[model samples]
Target chain A: MIPVLEAPPRAPSLDIDCELAAAWLVAFLRDEMIERRNVRRAVVGLSGGVDSAVTAYLCARALGAENVTCVRMPYRTSSTDSLDDARAVTEALGCVERTIEIAGAVDGYLVNEPDADGRRRGNVMARTRMIVLFDQSAKLGALPIGTGNKTERLMGYFTWHADDSPPLNPIGDLFKTQVWALARHLGVPERIVAKAPSADLEANQTDENDLGITYLEADRILSLMLAGYADAKIAARGFAPADVALVRGKVDGTHWKRHLPTTAMLSNTAINEFYLRPVDF
Target chain B: MKLAIVQAKPRKGDVEANFAALGEVFAQLASEERPYDAIVLPEAALTGYFLEGGVYELAFETEALAARIAALWRAAPGASRAPVDVVVGFFENAGGTFYNAALYLEIAEASHRIVHVHRKMFLPTYGVFDEERFLSRGRHLAAFDTRFGRMAMLICEDAWHAIMPTLAAIKGARVLVVPSASPGRGFAAGGELESVAHWRNVLQSYAVEHGMFVIYAGLAGFEGGKGMTGSSALIDPFGDTVARLPALGAAVLRAEIDFSEIDVARARLPLLGDLGSVLPDLLFDDDLMPENVRRGGERPVTP
Candidate 1:
């Protein structure tokens, strides 16, 4: 007698080979920064999160610990644990560390608009941190390396032009869960890896709470959605349809944020419009 | 015959700098204990791969290309005394139309001559590739005689199509040299980049199926953050890897290969012979034959 058999579940995974990813990312940073651009030192903004810690570790590995400078930019409302975790990363890597308080700089412009919302204040602080980071980079002749992960960038959770301002980014292509996996593989501190991610712009601001989904869920949904899967197909893979819709909405709606500003193309030589050149060119 | 695969990382839009760098590599190879009979470099070895509209500015005219390479060979320190063949990929400006082409040069102690030039046949226009937008397509394919034996060259995307290699094999090419600037992507497969793993399979299959030696030189380094995977390899006629470079970096890999292995492989398998005998009939099938030929009016001339 013939028997019917059930198919195996098709659960999606954001899993990557951490060893290969680390090696490729290290080589990428070394080539893009030291060899291609002829810059040996790197400046990374440390937010005491897994993403920043992984970036710091990669930078140290690529350019050596002596060439990486970790800057901790905290606002008045930032948690002390955040600062401690950032210090722990610097100590673990044996790289240069600096703590720059941006309360005065962010408040200087924010004082004129007391009615500004939390988002406005957070963006100001983010821009202020970038200003300080760029100034420090110029002072040391070091290039600023971006620490934003693919999940946050795709979700449009970063401050436009501020959090994504750096000219070199080794972790931009990695998803949040994938970055955490890489952090653990690189021997990052378990405290930073295990803690809930936050921007540290305000109190009790957890990323999962803000995004309404866990990073595991977001990464899985994103991996499937970005591969051109329909929402129904993604939902069929044991994900909630609402969550898939949310992730898809964020990814599709934030397309403009991922590109340079649109230019008016009145001629054949319009910059970034008609005329084209590779980024390195 | 001894062969060397040079996985090079050329600077973007810099022809003179790349030429000088290649000269250094040539000089280094010359001083080695064993001299190589042939050396192969990756596609767009003079200018980086993703030039877009910048190809117009960086392309070299046919005469200038031969002259520059000759000068580079002559000026290289510790130049090899024996005649050596070097295959290089470059953007060419031929009769006002630009093409992505490979130049085969035979260099001796006092003079150098152009052996052949193979313009890239397939210009990938999908995904990360925009070659068709910037370069003209090649219209011909032929196997040329070299000191090492009869050989053919296929640029990066051209090798992806099976017809290119089959045609080369049918044209009596004993060796296939592929110069590539393939960007590394798709790492979900495990240990190496998926592109690298896939390339390994493709290269081994080609070597085994055609019973021809495959020498692949892949570009290294980054262009616009896209890393060119460097898994340059020398595969023997039996689909064995004789030498290989690392997955990423600019390096030279050298190996001494026996040309007699091609004869042994073909003697045992004879896949090329089998394919050649059946290809004409397959081309003349109902679906493939021209209307006149299908109607038994006239047989088309075969090139």
Candidate 2:
């Protein structure tokens, strides 16, 4: 239950019409997946988090429960509760569910790199899961659905090509706070919705703690910054200067991740670098 | 006069496929027992919008376009011999220069006539739109005579400016058809899409201010993740929406165009007449106009 505040410290400017957003996203999924890609089935990686759970629900709504295949891939150190939560989502949605233990696959590669840090191991596990998702999608003739949200995407918190690999994402443009609101509207499991967001890469790892800022504060600052607000103005609006700077740095540093690999433009007819054509074209 | 507005979703960079689909639409409408006097399609109905460098290949000459459309109408089954006025937008290639234009054609069973063509005057070059880079802007605006009544056409960005509608009204146009290809954006606060709401507000204001029937034809479908807003509508001269399509997907909306409503609105408001009387003097008055406008130059001078 949300605590009702007579007067909150600050109202967020990220409110969206959940009803309209749901309809639009559902249609978007159908358009891109069904009509454009000529596929009626979806393969989604369910991490027991709000983002993946919401994506599962939308996939079920768009392509029906029978056509949506939810894959839960857990590394050796992944929380068991996360597996249980992911199972609960499949059960609630009545969609097909599969479990693939990625411990062996990730560990087989890491055995050679004994001095690898947690970040490297985490990336390995993420890419291992992506491999399973793509293979499963090919086996079932289904398309993989993306679940990255705007907050994590803008902060560049996702695994480079692993977490953001899918060609279509229904919730990529929504902020994390807004995704929570959408989850509630879509009747997502309350346990998943209320839990602290995590990549579940290591023990006692939480997203807010790693970023040194809460999602609420990060979303507010990022929204303002994206609207062309100066850093000083954002700090003047009661956001901590350090917090604003941190968010700005992460966003500015991750510009390469959001775009395709740059191509050398030798002539005016170069692909994507000079000779531009729309994706649909 | 009864009008039919088609919110079409053209395949990107494929004119043949779009024309085939449009042919099906004409056949479907012509098969109806109650014939329509006119049909209005959205801008870039034959070639999808947002084609950065693909417009050159898709652009068609006016005569070729007419010939193709006439062939399609002639081939469509159950089409009546009575002429049907069609207003559809396309990418036009005149000699070597290309432009974003709309054509007013009277399609019949055996013959077709190109009534008038309105090239887009205001090419939006900001934000997601990069029209001015690819196509040349139009120079003139005029109202032409039709079988049903005197009508005028304005491409999407042209209607965004108030002067376009005012000039069309002054030229004795009782009906204004605006072919638009606007993408949906800004979902903060309002229950509706912000772009759709803004279009409704401006279209209604233009209708009421000029006392003419405004028919808006909007494009629907996604191109490179940019979804076109499909809230096509018909607003009467009294600022009332007679018919409207949904905010998503392709659809066809039919509404009766009662020319007498224009008379009622003009008699009640008479704002167009008042503006017309003073527009002549306002155009030539040196003090009232900006120095650059009076000099007919592109740039403004320093005071």
Candidate 3:
């Protein structure tokens, strides 16, 4: 039998405003607990980024910090800088925090083959972090929270096996720049928000560096172009033609990844197709 | 003690054009000296309904359009006092997605400021209205603070959900403004009431139960090829329909609502006080389960 794999989650198309981001977590939890009455607690992956920090803060406000947990899963190469920032958030907000190191588990899985390529090493780190998060979530009876911001998700930059859990996300709609703005609003440390972001799997890894453009430029271009503004109008916003082309290609080519897996003879509930439904999806 | 409704048909996909058209109407009203305590407009007044457009096709330039609409509010004032607060519909793009929006316009002397903008939260994906197809549903349910009494806004499907208006009133909103667009032909498809009465009944019940006034405004045009039939009305905190619009045509509903009546009605009726009463032994197995009731735990037995 072929193994069934859950696709990694993609970020939302819109660049969410900070107020909306905080409001969504606030509203979802409030309605669920007050209206639905099933919710008692919330759990999140605190990556020390602005997105996760703000989500964590909102979850605490929505569910009370006593009922919220912040899980920090750090890889061996993961910098102490981010870990400290994550701790600062938990401590400042009076939230519970736990640490699970994944370097040993990932290192044990890799044969090294005399010398492994960078891609293999990075996958090992990304997948292992997800494994750690899910394992703890199951043990604690908590939901795993997603940490990817919208820009990375739009470009299909997240690892599938690690980040996509059906009900585990609270920050998928915010863009990278908006994430920074939210982090400041939530009182996260400046160093965490100001530094160039990275996955910490390699010596020099940053989202913009890998995407070949910064989020501020990409979001402006994507937002404007998506709004049907002319290329000339978008370029006037300080983006190079190459940057625009690269982002446009990424958005177009990976559009399939944003959708569900397609197949012939699609049903109302086909894997990746949209159709009429008896109930709301 | 007089009220006025400003019902204008929205142009498809042109917010700037719609704003211009509204300016003309406001000018005409000013010239005629048609003074009103408050003016209510349709949902998505800025950008016409995007029931068909996907994320890539919708217009979300709310930042640019708000100033223009606010300028129109600046043009209209009540009787030289605190000025009228105009409650109109528009599309907002604060979160990188098009939202079905309602704006509260308050004219202070010569300047009209948008005090609150409410986004449509409950997106209807089924039937003729596929709002989930374009804009992001809102996360806020509380009403805005306006001179028209602590007023709040709800769009289309939001009135059906009790929490949106309930939270608004709890947050100090005395008046709830619901802007709706009901499909005409779909009203009775094969003798099934497709959300026509549901819209009116839900808002009316919520107003009476919560002791809050409900000002419902619906678009008077055929939206999304669905041929929208208008059924706008104002329901007081007593669950009685105070004023209903014409059975079928372009008409702005105006009514005199004294919010001071709410406290007296509630004090006399005291129906909402029973909200906290528990029927632990009786199980309500019905289509409607007040969201709070479904989260079941055995009620403590009192001796």
Candidate that would win on lDDT: 2
Candidate 2 chain B: worst-modelled 10 consecutive residues by lDDT: B292-301
Which residue ranges in model 2 land beyond 4 Å of their true spot? A1-12, B287-303
In model 1, the runs with Cα more than 4 Å from the true position are A1-13, B290-303
**Listed models, DockQ each:** 0.67, 0.63, 0.01
lDDT of 1 by residue, B1-303 (tens): 778889999888877788889989988887887777888899998898999888888888877887777777767677668888888898999978999999999888888889999999999998889999888999899899988889999998889888898899999999999999999987777788889888888888889899999999999998878999989999989888887898788999988879999999998889999999999898777876476565546666889
RMSD (CA, angstroms), candidate 3: 24.2
Candidate 1 chain B, run of 10 with poorest lDDT = B288-297
User: For residues A84-192, could you state the per-residue lDDT of candidate 3 as single tens digits?
Assistant: 8889889887888988787788888786653778777887777887777777767766656667777877777766656554254555656677778777866777877
TM-score of each: 0.95, 0.95, 0.49
Candidate 3 chain B — worst ten consecutive residues by lDDT sum? Answer: B185-194
Error of 3 at A270 (Å): 3.9
Q: Evaluate model 2: give its TM-score.
A: 0.95
Alpha-carbon lDDT, every model: 0.89, 0.90, 0.67
Residue B176 shift from truth in candidate 3, angstroms? 14
Chain A TM-score for candidate 2 is 0.95
C-alpha lDDT (0 to 100) for residue A158 of candidate 1: 88
Model 3, residue A117: C-alpha shift (Å): 2.6
